[model samples]
Structure formats: C-alpha cells, structure tokens
Target: MPLHKVVYLANNTKLYLWKITEDLEELYNEVKLKDSSISRLDGMKSESHKKGFLAVRKLLQHIDYNDFDLYYDVHGKPNLKPQACGIKEMHISISHSHGFSAIALSDKNIGIDIEILKEKILKIAPKFMNLSHLDNLTEEEKIKKATVIWGIKESIFKIKNETGISFPNHIFEEDFNFEDKKAFAKLKFNNKLEDFKVQFDSFEDYMFVCAFQN
Candidate 1:
C-alpha cells in the first residue's frame, strides 16, 4: 500500500498519515531529492520517527517547500513563513505511536495526538485526571476515559503552542462522552478561558484525538 495519504479535516486543516514501506536507502534518497536537510538526519531511530518525517516532508512539498523556510521555536513547535499564496500563517503538530504518523496542518493553531488504548493508561491517570472525569466512570471505564482526557490535554498544549499548563487540573474537560466519540474542553490559562472541540476515533488499536481553537 502507498504510505502517504491526506484528509481534509476542516476548511483550514488537513491530516496526513504515513505508513512505512520503503527501505532506509530508498527513503533517504527520496527525502534528499526533496530537501537536503532531511538527508542529514539519522534514520536509524525507531521506524515511527522515520515514517513521520517522510510524511511531514511530503506535506511540505505540497505547499511549495522553497518559498517558505521551516524552523522550530524554542518550545519545539513547527512554524512556516509567509508563502507565495498570501494565505494566513501555517502551524503544524505531529504525533506518532506504534506504526502510524499523524500530522495536522492549518492556518490557525492546531494540535493532534494518538495513543494505543491500554491497561497502563489507568496507572498514570491520577497525574492528569480531574475529579469530574473520575466521577463519571467506574474502575473499568476509567482507563478509556483517562486515555481520551490525556489526549485532550495534550492537544490543548499543542493548540496553545506552549508548555507549563496543568493537564487535568487547571485545564478542565466537560460536555464530553467517550461512547459518543466527542468531547469539549475549557482551558484556563493566564486568567482567561478558551473553548475547544475534541473528537475521538479508533484507528487500529489506538485512540486518536484532534483539537484546535478557532
């Protein structure tokens, strides 16, 4: 199967998922042809990182790689400069787990995260789990709820394009049901509140969530 595919999630946002098929030599040569910078990176990391980078580079090509320069902020967020189209500035967030690499591209700030649903999620729940999330579920239900909540918080962090925000405590999630596959969040930061929409779905064995602020 082909490794690269694109989905239009919203008017301003697109999602790309890449599955690795080529060997390292082929991938290196392919990336080098598009951008010299990628050719310098070590491809021996994990398979996920290699696939993710290829997918991101392919997306960059679609947007005219030469006109815009790619650089990372101090916080590690990717930013793109003004392009020939005169469109709004573009922001991107990339997340990968297992064998899948997911990227979100949009004119506005965006964040996306994916995690395999596992029993281990229960063990880490307390660190970021809010009382409201716990109150709505039993022991067995908590694991899945916790996974979704974690994704929501991480997505918010990406949307804010900053760190140091509390996960489940300072940032609250409400008006969401896991079974219904949707959730809403109220993120409190710097004495102000912003609203977010979260959507969850199953892809292979992972639970994926995409969130953004308009």
Candidate 2:
C-alpha cells in the first residue's frame, strides 16, 4: 500500500515515519533481502529488528540518500559525507516505537522525536521536570503534562546532539504552549545559545514534535 508519513520541515529538513500495515513476517522478508544484516533471525528478536530496519530503509529513500556514505559515530549517531549535495553539514536523528519509525534530516543541526502518550510517563516526570513547570500543572494533569515535557526534552536532546544534560532545567523551553499548537526552546552549548521552534502535531496514534535551528 502507501508508504509512511513524510513531513517536510523546510527545504533542507524532512521527517519520515512509518505506520505499519503489512504482515510482520512479510515485511521482515523484504527487509532481509534489502540488508543482509537482518537475515539471521530464528526467533522474535530478529523479527522485531528486521521490521524496524526495513522501516528505516523505507524512510531513507524519501530523502537524498545518494552520494552520502552513512556511518555511525561512537555514540551511535549517523554521519554523512560533508560535501554531499554541496551541503557542508548534515544532521539526522531517528526514533521508532509501536509500529512507527522516524528520521529527521537537515542542513544545520536538528532533532525530531515522536512519543506515544502513555500513563507510565508520570512515574518518571520528577527526574527531568523543573519545579516551575511542575507547579503549573495540577495532580490530575500530571500525565499529559509529563508526556509533553518528555517530548520537549527528546527534541532538545536531538537538537543539542549531545549527552549529559538535564531537561527543562538545562534545556529551557520558552513561551509557547502545546495546547496552542506551538512552543519554543533554547539550548546553551559551548557558551553559545541556539533557539528552536517546536510544532506539535498528531499522526495516527502518535504525538510528533520537531525542533530545528535555522
């Protein structure tokens, strides 16, 4: 049938997400043929990995995947050839959950994340949330508030492309509300401040958030 959801953030940035439709076994077979790394399966784990990788490959073709040698760094982030397509730099992030996988690409640094809202987000809210943000929400509203906070943090994590930073506290989100369908965040790294705008949208059963610096 049709491919996954592809959202363009700008001329240089795009997001890809797959919504599964076909049988898992069939998809796994297709993925194995495309990438030999996926053919070693005899159990559930292999099947799951095959499906995810296939989804990733499907998304990759939607963008400029040619002339770019893809490799991963120590932290497992994908790197591209600098001079590919006359672009000096390329930044990308990948996320997948449930039956969906997503990739974000941009000329400058970018981070995109998707979350399926669930109740478990509430249990870990205190770890990443700040006092100011927590105080603004009532007890009954914690779960929804926590999910948005988690998404914002993930977006910032992708934007910063670094590790060892706290969310809401280190990466501060400024004035804009998801309820109003918009938000803005600022990340301070290496003594420089970078700003990003976050747009919240729903696709199927997922909550998608995209952040980028232009």
Candidate 3:
C-alpha cells in the first residue's frame, strides 16, 4: 500500500513506483487477480518476486485499472485492454527490483526499468556496458553509473522487444555525466539503427530509468 512516487514522462506517459513494504498475505488479500495472474503468482517461487508482482497490480488499481484490464503478448510485453469508448491505444511496461516495483503507461511506446544499485554490477560491467564510461570515477560512483547504464540498456530493450538483441552489442548509451540524470542511446541491429531518449533518477539505493523512441 506504499505508493512511493509517480512521474509524468514524455508523450503522455506515466510511471508509477511502489516500495514493497507489505507481507505476502497482505498483498495477496488486497490485490484482485485474474486467473492467469493467479497462476503466474502461484508459479513464483520467491516471496520477493510475489511481492513485486502484487505491488504492480496495486499500482494499476491506483490508476483505476485492474488485472482484468492487463495482458501480456507473445513477446512478454504488457498491454492494456482497449476501452469501449475507443480511446487511444495504451502501452505499458513493467519492472521490479529488490524492494521496488514500477509500471509505466503511455499512449506512446515506452520502456521503464528499476534496478537496485549494487557492487555486483561492477564485475560484469564490460559484458553490458562501455567500460570507459566508468573511468575517472570513484568506486561508489562507478557502481551507480554502471547500474544506470545497465538500466538504460534494459529500458531500451523493453522498447525494442526484439529477439537476438545483445545488451552490450546492440544497445549503446551516449556518454553523459551522472549528475545530469539523463542520456541518449542508439540501437543497431538487423541492418537498422534507431535512437532513443533516456531519462533516469535514483530513489534510495535504486535507479528508475525510462526510454522513449526518438
């Protein structure tokens, strides 16, 4: 029930963030799930994952939607059931990390990611990011910046949602200072090049990133 924050993004997109502070029973009782979601929830072995799943449903209710209004496609991207009034098509993206879960909704395509900053990212930075982007920074800064970069790629991938897209090979973030909290990225794959505008900010020890195709 702790709705952490809401951010309004470009193109009428809205990002809802929830900090998981409820126990499994509390969240399960509060969230009304469709049969598919119930099955998905039952299949989640980790209590942490279950909590994240329920928290996202809570976010939907906060905006006057519910599990019945949500569905996933073959690509695993979330979608909103069109309203009877013939409103604009709504696109949704969902993400969760250790203690947080987030959903971004928009009339335009958007991707969002929330990641807890951790030192583990440092060891694998080269696998998913440009190592030179971390140079001339303290260890702590490296973790934060690297995690943000990883989140950037994740957000873009969610936007693209294409198979065979490699994090380090397909998506690349344009170098930007950590203080700015925003950057740009390019995706090159299948003989196509596309640009994306990235926006990110940190809350507590986690980073929330959003991407809009440009």
Candidate 4:
C-alpha cells in the first residue's frame, strides 16, 4: 500500500509508517534497490523480511528519497546522504514488525522501533526491565506497557549505536502511563549518563516507539 500514517513526534521530526498489504512481488516491483540492497534482500531467509525491506524503500520514496540515498554504518544503523545544495543531512532510523514498516526522520539524532504485542514479553520482562513497573497492571495492560518499555530500550540502543550498552544494565525507562504517549529514559554507560525523550503510540496490535537525545 501507499504511506500508511505520518506522526509528528516533535518539531522537525516525523515518523512515517507503512502498513504492508502488498505481496512480495508487488513490493519488489515498486521500489528500485541498489545492488547491495538486492544482495542483502537475497540473503534474507523469509519472504516477510524481503517485503519489509522493500517496504522501507517504498517509504523512502514517499518522502522523495530512494534506496540510493540511504546507507548503513558499520553498526547497522541507517543513514541518509547529505542533501543536495547544502541542506542539512537527515537522521533516520528504520524498523519493521510483523506487518508494518516505519522510518523516523529528524534534524537531530533519532531512533525508532515497532513491535507486535504478545504475551511473551512478560515472560522475558525481568531480563530487560524493572519488573516492579509491571505491578498493578492487568494482563493486557502489562503486555502493552512491557512492549512499550522494550521498544524504548531498543530505540535508545539504536540511537547510541555503540558497543557494551546493555538494555537492563545501561538503558532505563521512567515509569510511564500508557495514555501519556511519551516518556523519559536514561542511558548509564561508560561512566556517563545521557538522557532521552521517548514518544510512542499503538496501532493494530503493534507498539511504535522513538527516542531522541535530550
């Protein structure tokens, strides 16, 4: 399908989402991929992954960008080329879940993630988050909240994009209400404490989260 949704997370920052309704061939036929992307897509083991890869390229097109203008760092973080005529380079983060792909663009550094809600997060919560935060929440609420926390950590990691940052040990989220649609977190790594502002939303059994350095 075309662009699914656009969310303004902050001034000069936008999150673009694409709901994957098209088949693999349809998506592949729509987006033009560079040889590197084609090789990466060929190496993918699942059709779902290939569609998600192409869907992101489709999103780039929605914003007047194409796969040729995007590249990844040694750490696997996505980036956009410097704009023509001296326009500021845009920071980008890419994510895809079961049936959705998303890209966040901003003048400042940013990270984003999307995850499908499931009961399994609760079982693994203690490994990555403070379980006490899950108290007093219903089963459904726990799943939603836990998924948000997980996304928060993942987004933070993407922003930092460095070695030795542990989700449970280095990244931490302040307690947040599901209704607030925003939160705060800190990364305590390398004898430094860095703060982040987090924004998130839910749609169709999926939780989307983005983090900005504060």
Q: Which candidate wins on TM-score? A: 4
> Model 4 over residues 16-94: C-alpha lDDT tens digits?
9999999999999999999999999999999998888999999999888999999898989888888621467679999
Q: Candidates 1 and 2: which is better by lDDT? A: 1
**Taking the tens digit of each residue's C-alpha lDDT, what string does model 3 give over 79-171?**
888981146888889998879999998877899999998999999997898899998999999999998899889999998899999998999
What local lDDT does model 3 show for residue 119?
96
Q: TM-score for all predictions?
A: 0.78, 0.75, 0.96, 0.97
lDDT for each residue of candidate 1 in 1-214, tens digit (9 for 90 to 100): 2545566777888876765566655655554343434553553476666655664565456555631356567887766656632667777777877666677778767889978778888888777876466675777567677888889888888878656688865677884667898788888888888998877766666767788774
lDDT agreement of model 4 with the native:
0.93
Of models 3 and 4, which has the larger TM-score?
4
TM match of model 2 to true structure: 0.75
Least accurate 10 contiguous residues by lDDT in model 1: 31-40
Show where candidate 4 strays beyond 4 Å. Answer: 84-86
Ranking by TM-score: 4, 3, 1, 2
Model 4 vs. true fold: TM = 0.97
Per-candidate local distance difference test = 0.70, 0.65, 0.90, 0.93
